[model samples]
Target: MSKLFDLGLMVRTYRDPLAWLTLFVDLLPIIAIVFFGWKAIPLVALYWLENLVIGAWTLMRMLGTIAGNILNLPIMLFLGPFFCVHYGMFCFGHGIFLQAMSGNDQGGAFGGGPVALVEWALGTAPHMIWFVAAIAAVNGVFYLVDFLILGGYRKTQPIAEMFSPYGRIVTLHVAIILGAGLMMAFGQPLLGVLLLLFLRVVFGMALNMMRRLKLDGGLPKTLDPFADMQVETG
Candidate 1:
């Protein structure tokens, strides 16, 4: 580990085009909200969509980590099916709830029965296509930032290194949910949007700090992946 933080390195790294693009991708949601107006998109729906996307992404990363470290097999065995079933139900249930809240008639789309319920649940995919695409783009940019800019290939970082992204995802979701709640309570969704933008900036900084710490070997050598699981499950 370096005795001192290298400010020069930080400055030079941030000046790279990939770094700039990463920042832009990180800020995309805020930019979109500002451009379209806060209420133009459904805040709750967007948050739920992000939850689904992030959950799936986390599962994929966990599987990749497991592939690299056979010792992680036990954790993978437990979590793989768990997350799939949990997130599947979570997404479908929440999608239906949101549709109901918006007064979208799913029954009419599928002839009004239990079959219709199943159809509506499955139908969330089509409805979420654009939001899912936007989130996938953001995640793709983050992957580039991790691999190309953040020394992911320099040496194998611990699975715990994945925590930073997970933390950011959770934080963004909470900020949006709380902000939207406040907006409804006080009739100021624009204020909520501004709050989300501010939180995104803070989240970006937090991620940068994590990357720097990893570079400096300041991060723990091993962190219990179970701890991460607890955070997600709780």
Candidate 2:
């Protein structure tokens, strides 16, 4: 409701240069789609699909860690790094897959066949490493803004705090999909991209409000399950 559209909060949230840079990065895919037409669809699909997959992976790890802690198990400690590495590999794999698919579809320099696809994938594999690293680097900045600047960690356990970005990714992806579908149905792809961007900003503001409430210890009782858990564990 009103909490989701707090303009004041939105203004304050994006005041930082890092926040603005993150938003700019988020807008790049939409820009590509608008300028490059359908040729950019595969790349855009790859980008968001990677986010969705990694988000799901992160969510699983967070839930696993939370459950392990609740049950007094030690396995969660070992899972942290394992899940991170697995997520990185998953991103790289998707990057290669997208490259192969796009190359075959284009059928020019890449040609259309298994061998061409294999060659393209091999040649691009090293670049995919850099691509994955760049994604991690951007996400690192987001983590810093969310946790340190916004004080997200002050409001919840590390596992729960880690869940926030994944939650945002899933929500933003759904918004973009729905918005794009409606726009395409009406033959208004540009409008749809604009809608996607608007929804992202709205959702981003809502998330910031939630985080602020948590940091201030003002979150509703029912929504604050980890508060008591922290007290018990500490």
TM-score: which candidate is best? 1
**lDDT of the candidates, in the order given:** 0.53, 0.47
Q: Which regions of candidate 2 deviate over 4 angstroms?
A: 34-40, 43-75, 78-135, 145-155, 158-166, 169-173, 212-234
RMSD, one per candidate, in order: 6.6, 8.4
- State the lDDT of candidate 1 residue by residue for 1-234, as single tens digits: 131246764675475564565466556655446564534135445655665666656665666565456776787677678667765665555555555655675455335543454444334433345545766776666555654465343333334533423444456557757776877888976777677667766555444544444444554342222233333335
Clashing pairs in 1: none
User: What's model 2's overall lDDT?
Assistant: 0.47
Worst 10 residues of 1 by lDDT: 220-229
TM-score of 2: 0.51
Top-scoring candidate (lDDT): 1
